[model samples]
Target: MKKILFAFALSCIGFISTNAQSLYNSNSYFGSSSSTSISSTNSSVRYQQGYTRKDGTYVNGHMKTRSNNTNHDNFSTIGNSNPYTGSTGSVAKDYSVGAYNYGSGKTIHTGSRGGQYYINGNGNKTYVPKRRTRY
Candidate 1:
C-alpha cells in the first residue's frame, strides 16, 4: 500500500512539474519575442517600439481615446467621451467588476490523489472518479 501510494504521488508531482515548465518556459509556442514585430498607422491605438503610448477604440462608428492618462480635464469635452451621454463626456477608465469571487460557478481543482475534481452547486469540491474498464 505504501509503495503504491508513493508511486502515485511521484507520478502526480512529475506531471505537474512538466506541465508548468511547458506552459511558462516554452517560448517556441508563444514566439521567440525578437522575431515578432508590430506596426500601425492611422490607427486608433499607438505604440512605439512595443511600448503602448495611446489606445483608442471605435464605438458607434466613432474613434475615441480609451486611455484617461490625458493632460487636461474633460469637463468641457463631455460630448467626445465614451458612453458619453452628452452630459458627461469621455469615460476613460478601467472599471472594476462587482461580483463575488466564488458563487454558483463550477470550480475546478486537482484531487489530492492527483485526479480531477470539480465543485458541486453547494460549493463543495468533489473528486472525480477514475474511469474503469471491464476485463
Candidate 2:
C-alpha cells in the first residue's frame, strides 16, 4: 500500500542520514560548501569567518577583522637569571606553555609572542626574535 511504501522510504532516509558522516570527517569529497550565509549591503565592512575542527584546529580559511581605532602599545620588562632546573631523565613542560624538561637536557622558554628560547649544550640562553609583518 502507499502508506507502507512511504513509511519504508522515510525509514531508509533516516537510516542513511544517521550512518552518514559529516563532510569534515570524510576525506573523499572535495568542493565548495557554504557553511553559513550572510545578508548585508555594506561592502566596506570586513567580515571574519572561519571553521575549526573538533580538536580546535582550523583549516582551509583565513580571518579578517575591521576596526575603526588604532593605538600604539609599548611593553618593557626586566628579569634575573634564576634558571629553573628540570628533573633528571624526564621531560619537563614538554608540551604546554611554560614547560620545562630535563629528559632532553635543555631549558626551553616559550613566549606568548610565538618564538621559543632554549638553552644550548653550553648552558647559554638563546633568544630568537619572531618575524615582523610588513605594512
Candidate 3:
C-alpha cells in the first residue's frame, strides 16, 4: 500500500508539472504562443507579443519593419543594431556610388551580385566588368 501511494504521488507531480509548463508557454510569454507577420515584395512587418523560449530566454513584445526609402528612422541599417536579434548591419556608410554628376541625374546603385552597376540610359542594369589581370 505504501508503494502504491508513492507511485500515485509521483504521477500526480509529473502531470501537474507538464500542465504547468504547457500553460506557461501558451498563456504567458517568454516565447511566442502565437505570432503574426505581414510581408510585401519591398517591405515586411513582424509582431512578437512577448514570447519566452524553452531555453529560458525572454523575448519582449516588439514590432519590426523593413522598407525601402522609408522616411522614418530605421534601426536595422548600418551603424544601428536590430533590437530583436541583436545583430549589426554590415554595409559601409559610403556604399552608395552617387549620381553621374556630368549632366544626367541617373543615380548609381549596387547590383545583386556584389558588382558596381548603374542603370544605363536604356533603363537596365549595366554591370561594370572588373579589369582583367594580365598573366
Candidate 4:
C-alpha cells in the first residue's frame, strides 16, 4: 500500500512540473539578434563589432592604433581604446563629406562620386595602405 501511494504522489508531482511554462519567452525579445564584425579592406587590425537587425541597426567597434605591449613596438596607433557605438546611421554623421571649413570656405568631401558625402570640421579623412605590422 505504501509503495502504491508513493508512486501516485511521484506521478502527481511529475505531471505538475510538465505543465509548468517558462517565465521568460523569446517573443518578448525585440529585433532578433544578428551580430558580425566589420573587417578592414586593407588590413586585418581594424574591425567593427555590432548587430544589424531587420528592425534596427547598431554598431560598436574599435581601431587598433597602438599596441599594449611596449617592448615589441613596431607601430603606434591612435584611439584604439576608444569605441564607436551608435545606430548604423550614425556612421553617416561621423564621415560627412561636405565638412565645411569655416575658415577656408571650401568644402571637403570623402568617397567617390558614386558615394555620398558629408563634410565635417576636424574630420581628418586619411587612409593608410595596410601592411605587415609584425615581422
Tell me the TM-score of model 4.
Answer: 0.18
lDDT of 2: 0.35
lDDT of 1 at 48: 18
List, residue by residue over 16-108, the lDDT tens digit for candidate 4.
433321211232332236243322111223332456755476654433323322212112222111222221221211222322222233333
TM-score for all predictions? 0.22, 0.18, 0.23, 0.18
Best by lDDT: 3
User: How many pairs of residues collide in model 3?
Assistant: 5
lDDT string for model 3 (48-117, tens) is 4788976699988664554444312344444444544567644322222321222234454555654545
lDDT of each: 0.37, 0.35, 0.46, 0.31
- In model 1, the runs with Cα more than 4 Å from the true position are 28-135
For model 4, where is the 10-residue window of minimal lDDT?
71-80
lDDT of 2 by residue, 25-132 (tens): 344443457444321111122223567866699865321223322101101101111111111221122233323222244444656755456677666656432222
Q: Write the per-residue lDDT of candidate 1 for residues 10-126, one digit (tens) a residue.
A: 566556644653664466766787455321111122111223323454334322333343312332232232222334533221111211122225444545654444677666665
